[model samples]
Target: MEKYDYEQLVICQDKESGLKAIIAIHDTTLGPALGGTRMWTYASEGAAIEDALRLAKGMTYKNAAAGLNLGGGKTVIIGDPKKDKNEAMFRAFGRYIQGLNGRYITAEDVGTTVEDMDIIHEETNYVAGISPAFGSSGNPSPVTAYGVYKGIKASAKEVFGTDILAGKKVAIQGVGSVAYTLCEYLHDEGAQLIVTDINEEAVQRAVDAFGARAVGLDEIYSVDCDIYAPCALGATLNDQTIPKLNAKIVAGAANNQLELDKHGDLLHQKGILYAPDFVINAGGVINIADELNGYNRERAMKHVDKIYDNLETVFAISKRDNIPTYIAAERMAEERIASLRNSRSTFLQNEHHVISRR
Candidate 1:
């Protein structure tokens, strides 16, 4: 293992905003780190740290798997985006990025919106997910959903031997941006949809838009469907929930779906085809990563549309290696990132001496 793999991750916290930000520049070989700026009210600094580190690492694998020329890094603002965000707080975050120079780039994710990125942009040049006016491809959730749609097709092929998507029952666990878009795709495919979300408005939107059956958050584990897609949060399926899943496949835009490492094996044992969360949901990152140069909305979309190919490769690798699909996908992505880092070691600082570079 590379020393980078074991290196202590760097993080900067702003006390005034109670922002416990982390920059897990998983690999800087390709370029400065680029990921999202997700704002959430974590219970504690320790919880925030855990989330930032895990999410940053997932970004690394996501970009690598998508073959993007960027690294993985993420920031977590410890406040409610709906009510707690202010200009001063974002500006403070910008200062943190400025201090890091160009090593870690930030964008919008989960709790944070594109408008938030615009605020962060005021403080530093190291920001993506800026508004369209700022010459950025904003709100990558739709593209992320596109990738998940394609991935669902690939998973369908592996499990059902077809990607036609029609008549497939897909239970979406969240009606957020990406999941909503995924529902749109599934709706077009004539898939029977079951959707759930903590947000009532989002659930109603699903009801109005696609006639998706609204399931309660507590009942998600019991939904009888061909595919149980957990798009809301991570670790939706664990020891208890996994046993209750009637879905033959589990794939969605949620990050770090496995609560623990052992959960991967649990899914494998249950014969449920699992597409790694980061791999399937990488469409958004792939799109934003495209904006570093000339913004080509069409070209960026084409890259995202290629999620089918990635899904196929992951599925094939899983079968060929007789390993869990999630592990197979992660290994594939890790190997690709390792290769890129090795190729660029001569140009980057501290890269040659420390393989544990993350």
Candidate 2:
């Protein structure tokens, strides 16, 4: 907890359901912690806890950067989603969330689904991304993709002095659901696309739909392009790959694109305008957060569109502070949280004074 300044960490278990999970709350200065629950077959208990803590901290920054009145938390179930899932397990998990008394809110994430969230909802009203019938926001991928698209445009404007994507070459590192939708938007803008994926079918789909050129997985990093979008996995911007990048900008849907803080610094040194992953990929969280206020699609979309403006702000801070964009993003979030923390402290002191007078 001291390493990351975590707020809380809970270990939950249910023998009957074979449920073993870790919930980590990293911050709540802005508001209650909101993040998704991920189920994975972690190698060890410690690994699961570490993942939960790291992800929770990332959510704190992601939420604050997106301008959401929420903090960061995350849950990790130590099991295989494919073979270990059961209704009883999810209900048990939900009960654990209920025990938090609204300090942490969970939704669907990798190895989990809306159905799992719905099951969790049975035990706690604190869950988001449940079925739309329950007034929840459905699949956040499209909204996330839209935000990345807008972020890319903002980065383009910063680098090329215009946001027009027509005739620009883009290398997309994934053709998954979010990246596929992002391709549609970029294709419509006449951006030339070079794509790659581990799944040939997915790659073929992008090729057929967007007329994208398919390349080998390793070939993606060296592709000649104006922008490189790493939409697949995290840490693609490490020491090995950074030197191979031929793009002028890095913007995508992946979380934790930089393997380490120094890699972000390396990108900055190379003059690559990187749209910080947390800031650009905040649309999904922004989409689900709207559920707190009765789930308005238009309102959520308008909020997602602000990703462009958010990136603009990050860039401005980068220039003003002469720091990497990643550092600037962190500064922005920290400043917001610090301001709110001060105001809340004053409000509480004033309330205490009134009570003391009475």
RMSD of each: 4.3, 1.3
Residues 54-107, model 1: lDDT tens digits = 777777778888888777787777777788887777888888888888888888
Q: Relative to the true structure, how large is the alpha-carbon lDDT of every model?
A: 0.83, 0.96
Provide TM-scores for the models. Answer: 0.91, 0.97
lDDT at residue 291 of model 1 (Cα atoms): 85
* 215: Cα error in model 2, Å: 1.0
Residue 133, model 2, lDDT: 96
Stretches of candidate 1 off by over 4 Å are 1-20, 341-358
* Backbone clash numbers for all candidates listed: 9, 0
Candidate 2, overall lDDT? 0.96
Tens-digit lDDT track of model 2 for 1-358: 9977899999999999999999999999999999999999999999999899989999999999999999999999999999999999999999999999999999988889999999999999999999999999978888899999999999999999999999999999989989999999999999999999999999999999999999999999999999999999789999999999999999999988999999999999999999999999999999999999999999999999999999999999999989999999999999999999999999999999999999
